[model samples]
Target: MTAPDRFSFNQATAKYWPIPELVAGCVEAGVGQLGLWREETNAYGLDKTAELVRDAGLAVTSLCRGGFFNTPDWYDENRRAIDEAAVLGAPVLVLVSGGLPEGSRDLDAARAHVGEAIGALVPHARAAGVRLAIEPLHPMFCSDRCVVASLGQALDLAAPYPADVVGVVVDTYHLWWDDQVWAQIARAGREDRIACFQVADWITPLPEGVLLGRGLPGEGCVELRRFRDAVEAAGYTGPIEVEVFHAGLWARPGTEILARTLAGYLAHVD
Candidate 1:
């Protein structure tokens, strides 16, 4: 079956897929949308990757990241990320707020810093025509990766900015366990803060890193269709990016992975 109109394949799902091959495979599979990560694009030469995807008629739904507020150079780093998003025509730059600063256990302070950092970058992001999307990773990542661990907090952080300037991502992989997520999703819609929507299922026996433990759309227990319906009901009619990150999935051929992703998305999400 053909992918849904809103379906977007995040390149990370096929982590090992080279840019050229990934683009070719997407074209062959009739996939028209993609989500990109910085490392891969930077390695392939941003401009070259941009040109390749543009020429192939694939639209970039969002760029993987631009946040890590705990870092000393966050301001400059995020500005560069905004520039790159503009270069690639991605409307949104996903921000993964960094964990607590070394030796600091103040969660409140860390989250507060995330808001301030976004406020600082708003002007640049606005000038570049890119929206800053705050992504709240699972609380498990709180100490070392992302401290903003809930959609409620993400919305709170975005409350100070214009809805167009700052928004939040609704990723099932990280948010499915929250009972308040439904309410938060509605609030996000009413507030116009839902910038990007992604899907991945939660599986047991997480891998060593935990970062790569995500399962494809239906492989785990998430209510994929329910989340899809929630976002749609909340008035978000943007791309629905499948962003699973598992080593086993990545080991498959790019086209094969894309096919499986499409199947899972169709069966469980669309």
Candidate 2:
């Protein structure tokens, strides 16, 4: 089967696009899907942001994020995020399971915390008509950002939950280096756990302590075509969301970045 024809640009990459203008630009660019940020949605007012996206005929691919499972008050925060996602008509609420708590060296403990938190949020997310997309951050981010470091592990945590309420985000930048990624992707597809598929290239020697360093497609070492093929072969036919987090790219004009990103994706991805 042919891949879906929609591709989306994450607003986070266009850090400069004020809400309304970003919506307009997304529409103008023929982008059918969008990833909304809580801060931006709040800045524009949830209703207004949702209206803008709907008016522009854009589909809410997935919300920027929910879940910092390591925090003492993580449950409340994640529940609120689920509500916000519902307000925006976003079907999936991306979750970044937070880092270890202060004085905590047990990564396994942190992971258990994430699983419990997700288990609690499952019903709320289901009630809100939103699916929780567990984003397995790169191993590089294990210390300070997220404990979900592999698709396999994320799947393990999600196994007990209903598929309609919990799934996974296959961001190439994070999972590309994983030796078992292909198998996990296939499993996610088989289980219908592929909620979102994002693309970004991997760059090394990234700034210490920051897990946001990612490159535009074709600008780094990831085998985008192979990855795309694997995802597609697994029966996931969804928008390919471009989410580069490079400081330099963010500084450039949004249009330039969008154009380059689309071109790179087309040139380097299958």
Candidate 3:
């Protein structure tokens, strides 16, 4: 069977796009899914933002974030994020396992901390009908941002949880460099652990200390069609949310970036 259609855009890309205008632009572009951010949601207020999306008839694929597990006092913060996801009817909460504590040498310890934190919040997430989507950042981000740095690793961390409560996001920019990505995708499919499938191209020689250099779909070196096919073969039919974090792209007009992004996705996906 042909893969079912599922495409989404994260509003965070439109950081420069005014909320009302962005919603209208997304609707006009025929983009059906969105990933909302906590700061933006709070700024617009949940009710107003939801009404805007509702008026545009958009489906919220996932909330931008809900975890920063390295924090010593992150529990309450995470709980509040869970509540917000439920309020917005977002099915998944993208988690970026936080960085190492100051003067700490133990990466493994930080990862363990992530496990403990997620374990603590799983019950609350389930209660709120929010699936925790563990996003394995690229290994380049291992030191400062995410300890979980591979799709396989994220899957291993989430294996014990019930499928509906936990799963993994397969982002092309993050996992495309892995030699074993296809194998991991099959494993995720076998276990039904794929929660979100996102995309952005990988750019090299990344600037110093800057974590966000994501390229537009066709601008960088990624095997887009192969990645999409593997994820589809693994039984994930969720929206393909394009999450580019480029400063250049972000500075451009929202409508132009979005229009180009949609065209690029269609060009590369098939």
Against the true structure, whose lDDT is highest?
1
Evaluate model 2: give its TM-score.
0.95
Better model by TM-score, 1 or 3?
A: 1
Q: Model 3, stretches more than 4 Å misplaced?
A: 1-5, 205-209
- For model 2, the local distance difference test gives 0.85
TM-score of each: 0.99, 0.95, 0.95
The segments of candidate 1 whose C-alpha lies over 4 angstroms from its true place after superposition are none
Winning candidate number (TM-score): 1
RMSD of each: 0.7, 2.4, 2.5
Clashing pairs in 2: none
Writing each residue's lDDT as its tens digit, candidate 1 over 134-205 gives 999999999999999999999999999999999999999999999999999999999999999999999988
Q: Quantify all predictions' global Cα lDDT against the true fold.
A: 0.95, 0.85, 0.85
Better of 1 and 2 by lDDT: 1
lDDT of candidate 2 over 1-270, digit per residue (tens): 122256777888787768887777666666667887898899779998888788888888889789888878888888889999998999889999988888999999999988988999888988899999999998878988899999999999999999989999999999988999999999999999999999999877675535467888888889888888998999988878888877778788776777777787778874
Residue pairs in steric clash, candidate 3? none
